[model samples]
Structure formats: structure tokens, C-alpha cells
Target: MSTSPTDSVLEGVLADLAAEGDLLETLVADLPEAGWRTPTPAAGWDVATQIAHLAWTDEAAVAAATDKTTWDALVTELIGTGEQGVDLAALAGGAVAPVDLLSRWRTARTDLAAALRAHPPGAKLSWFGPPMSATSMATARFMETWAHGLDVHAALGVEPEPTDRIRHVAHLGVRTRDFAFAVHGLDRPTEEFRVSLTAPSGDLWAWGPEDAAQTVTGAAYDFCLLVTQRIHRLDTSLVATGRDATTWLGIAQCFAGPPGEGRERR
Candidate 1:
């Protein structure tokens, strides 16, 4: 049986997702309890909370893939419950022992990979925002893992080894250009912006037309950091060539939910 293009694409995304998760695990595996309690740049979140949030979201992604009933219930419980405070699941998960929390994250991500691989091709799964194909969901997972890994690495006073894997994040950032405006209640741009990024491998990865009036050009790493809100606009090397394109850099977010309070200038 020949595999579909979607299947091949999903396999690539899954591989990158696992690698990103492993990178996070390697960073946290030997940390002492106090290290897990160290504050990251996410304001109130500690290192443990970052890991726990990844684990919880992985579990939720699995539920979204495999169980509609459970997914809907999760939506009801987690989606509109800012009234209960931010990320009840992360807070609860972060309260566990560091060892147990690590174990759970490992298990949840493993299960999530399997669930995504087994998901029906061409089917869209329910999510907090729009439904996503398995490939898109896995890519989103990679994006979050990389973003949260940034927090953990920062907390540990360590620099992450940058790789071409950040292309997944950069791709999402370019794709969410309109969402960035819409989320902030601004009108969507009437035209597509050309995005050109230099990947860690020194290769160019670009999107949109070669002749588009609006253009965003930068390093893929900085673009990923910007879109994830891991780095503030003022700190990145990204350059935008049009009015809305410049503004989009300020508000760009690849992830779902309300706009996040981004990082401060270094």
C-alpha cells in the first residue's frame, strides 16, 4: 500500500516533535528539585510549570485525536475557565514530584505521537480553536515544545543548540499572519506578505509571492522566538517591509488563545 503525501508529511512532523520533546527532557532530566522550582521568564511559571504545561497539552492533544467525548469535556473544562485562573491543569500537574512529572510528560508525549500517527488521514480533530489535521496538530505540538523549552533553558541559564527543527515553528508563524491581526481585533491584511527566513542550516525557507508588496525577512530562529512570544519584537533581527507587516511582527502569535503578554526586551 502506497502512503499518501499527508502520511509522509505527518511522519516528518512527528519525528521533529519527538526530537524537540527529547531536547526538553535532556534539559530537565538531571535538575534538582530546586532547579525545577526556579522561575522562568513566563512571570509566575516555574520550570516545572513549563514542563507540566507541555505534558498537559500533549495529553489533551491525544484526547482530541482519540476521544471526541473526552475532548469536548476538556474544552468545557479548560477553554473558558479563566474564571478558575490560568491553566488549572498546568498548576495541578506542576504540583507533583519532579520525577513523577517528568514521567508523566514522557508518557503523555509518547501517547500523543502514537495517537497522531494513528489518526485518520484527511480528518480534522477538534481543538480549543479551529480543528486541525493530525500533521498540523503535531506541528503545533513541536512549536509549543520548542517555546517552553526556551523557558526551561533560560531558567537553567543554558543556551539551547539551535537546529533546523525551528522551521516548523517558522512555518506556523508565517501561516498565522492573519490570526495575529484578527486576535488583536485589527483588520486582516488584504494582501499576502512574502516571508523569507534563513534557517539554522543557512538555507532559505520562504513563503508567499516573490513579488508581494509586503515582506518579512529574518533569521528563522529569531522569527520563531518572536512568534512564540519567547522574545520581544525589539530584541529580534526580523525586518518587515510594509506597514501592516511591521505591525504584524509586534502582534504575531502562532499559538491559539487570547494574546499573550510577551517577553521583555533583553
Candidate 2:
């Protein structure tokens, strides 16, 4: 059944969440005990710790859905921590340990998705700060699932083929172009930019104006990896077609927050 973009976005995220969870399960099924302790691509965090953090995030998602006060407080705490001249990188990059965090994360994610699916479309939820519709909340969850899956992909050395659904997520990156510009204190270009992605199903997912002067071209999977900060900008064949396009090429971000350091060509 066809659904509105808002509904579709959440639906897609839920689907992807389920799929990624299955993949993670398979990836860790036969691993050695010490493999869980091995460091992941995320600086300083090992596989076990990453799983634990993912679980914590799932719990946070549930809290946001049911506890507005706690949700608001958590977001405030995060932003305050960021603004207090705290070195986020340093804080995030310390203490890589393996723990039994994955199971909880997996379970929470399942429960959260189920609860969200049952909520009314107009349901109000507290996120980072403002009250967001249930739809926006779903999109946020999708963005995190895709972004974190990147970490798992890196750890497993396996490249997940891009599904047409990725375009659903990638579109978030494209539409958020203005926000990305604002993140760097730059004015958002008044002009539109085009994006084309080749999906795994042998179908094409296209967005923006065909005649847009600025364009991003590449396989859809690569584009997803780039925007999600999974693969390095240089590692992907995705290219920008206009003057400032390249500058914005690798900097696309759909997830929330005060912008992050864009991926660099290492």
C-alpha cells in the first residue's frame, strides 16, 4: 500500500532496522570471543562497546517516545555538553570495551519500532528539543540505524548492497542540504541540486531537478555510505557536477544535531 512520505519514511526505517538487525546477528554468530573485543572503525570503541552504545541509544529512543520530560532533559544535556567546550571526540574516543550490550540494543530496537508502528500519525513525541510528529521521530530513528550500521559494516568488512530504500534515507540527506550549509555557517544556496542513485534492485532512484546545475552522481549505495559518514569521501566514486557541488558533495548530513565534521578524503 502506498503511504505519504512521512509514513513511508518511518515504514522504510522500520524495515531497514529489522534487516540490519538480522545482518548483525549473522555477522557475530560464529565470532571468536575475542573478536567481540576487537576495535571497530569508530575510534576507540570496540565491537562489544559499540553494541552496548547501540542498546543505550535504543533505550533513549523509547524514553523519547514515552517520557517527554526525560527526553527533553537528555537532549539538553547533550547540547550543553557539546557547548561547554567539551571535546566530544575525546569523550567519544575513549575506553573501548566489550560488554553484553548488543542483546539489549537489539531487543530495545524491536520494541521501539513496534510501539512506534502502533502510535497515531499525529502523535507528539519529544526529541532533541521540540515536539516532533511521530513521523519525524521515525525518520530520526532511520537516520541513526543507517549511520550506526555503517560502523557495523566497517567492523565486518562487508559492504551491504544499497537497496532502493536507501534512497528513502539518502533523500533525507539531499533535502537537508540547507541545514548542512548552515552547519558550517554558510548560506544555503538558493539553487537546487540533483541526485541519482542506482539501487540494488536494478531500479533507479532519482531526486531533485534534472537540470539542476549542481549534481551528485554515483551508485546509490556509495552515496548512502558517503552521507552517513561510513566510507571516506575519496573512497567513493560519487562525484559532484558544479562549482560548489564538490564542496557540499561529501558533506551531506540528514541526521540531527549541530552538524558534524564531514568526511574527508584521507
Candidate 3:
């Protein structure tokens, strides 16, 4: 991978996600017989279900990328099968063992990453909601993987740091900050805010105008966790300074479409 600004950030994210996936694989594979049955934060779903869901989603993403027949067909399948609060629930409800599901998931991520590297950056691709560049779609998938990894992190009581690339995923969330607010029927802020991430490498990832009206300061992992709604803002000492800063913190979204409810507590 080239070490240009964009490629560097993206590669960093890929490496971080890969490491997290390795941890996830080990955790699921080592689970006691009863561990697979332990309930995850996701409603009515256990660890097995979560792993299955990851496998299913990852495969669908890869299908959208490489298979001509699977282009829009898979998106239709997902929307048709999924219901509110359980988007992957219906797809993952199977008899497969947690280990099997995770193994498949590992393969899918590996394949997807390879596909992304092979395709040209500007290649158009089919995603769930909108058409996107291959690179953009890859970034979205990366965010999804990281977000779900946070769930496992929560369950395992481990705090995983983003080595450096979390800034890519975090930038995605920053881009959608307005969309997230609008999803909640709230007005997008007129004022811009600066977001600075102190990555585990001690390198800084900064977004927004340097002299913006508001600022959010924290470790990159905490910011990623907050924007993804994996961790409640109250759970960390992430600082959102300025009046508009608090407002932006209230709604930060990375995904497309209507904004999600996000976390209730600030």
C-alpha cells in the first residue's frame, strides 16, 4: 500500500481491524460451551448470533463487490429480510456453531480486503443504500467491522486502541455529523467544529478548520466508540468544548440514510 495521506490512513484502519478480528476469532473459538450462549448487548441475540451476523454481513458485502448477480440482489435481500433493531438478526438465525461463523467471517474480511486492493479506487460499487466508489465502500465496510468489534470489546471488557487508521473511520463519522443530527429531526449546526485524535502511535489526526468554533478531544478509540454508539459518552471523559461542540457531540453519524437515535446520555 502507498503511504500517501489517504492510503496511509486507510491501511492503518485495515491493519487495526484485522488485529481486532484476530482477537475476536480467538475469543469465539475459546468460548466455553456456555459462553456461546451468553447474551450480547444486542437484544435477544447471543455471542453465537452476533458472530453469525458478522459472517453473513461480511459475505454480503463481498458479494456486492465481486459478484455481478449479487449486485442489487443482495441489498434487496438484506432489506427484505431485516427488521428494525435486528437488521442482521434474521440472516444470522442458523444452527451453525460460533466458531464456524467466525471462521467464515474471517475469510470474508480477508477476501473483501483483497478485492478492495485489486479494484481501482474510482470503481463504482453497490452498497446497501447508495452507489459508491470502491474505496468509499471499502471504508464503509471497515467502519462496520470496527463498530461490531466494539460490541465484542464491550462483552470481553477489553479496551482496544486504534493504532493509527481509526482516523479514517472517524473521518467518515465526522462527514456524517450533519446527517446524524438531521436523522434525529434536529437542525445541523451552522458552526464547524474541530476534532483531534491522539492515536496510540502519538501521531495526531485532525479534522475540520483549525480555528473552528468547537472542539472534541480524546483518544481515537474513545472517539470512534462514541461516534459509533458502541460506548456511551458518559462512560469516557471525552471532552466536547464550546456550546456547538456539545450540540455536535449529541449527534455524530458516519453511515448514510436517516440518522440513528444515537446514544441518549451525553
Q: Tell me the TM-score of each prediction against the true structure.
A: 0.97, 0.81, 0.82
lDDT of 2: 0.68
**Candidate structures ordered by TM-score, highest first:** 1, 3, 2
Global Cα lDDT for candidate 1: 0.91
TM-score of model number 2 = 0.81
The list of candidate 3 runs beyond 4 A from truth reads: 1-13, 81-94, 158-162, 256-266
Task: Report the Cα lDDT for candidate 3.
Answer: 0.69
Q: Between the candidate structures 1 and 2, which one is better when assessed by TM-score?
A: 1
TM-score of candidate 1 relative to the true fold = 0.97
Name the regions of candidate 1 deviating beyond 4 angstroms. 83-86
Which candidate should be chosen as best, given lDDT against the real structure? 1
Clashing pairs in 3: none
lDDT, each prediction: 0.91, 0.68, 0.69
Kindly list the per-residue Cα lDDT of model 3 for residues 122-187, writing each as its tens digit: 577776666776567667776776676666665667666565556667878787777777777887
Per-candidate RMSD, Å: 1.2, 3.8, 3.2
Please report the candidate that would top TM-score against the real structure.
Answer: 1
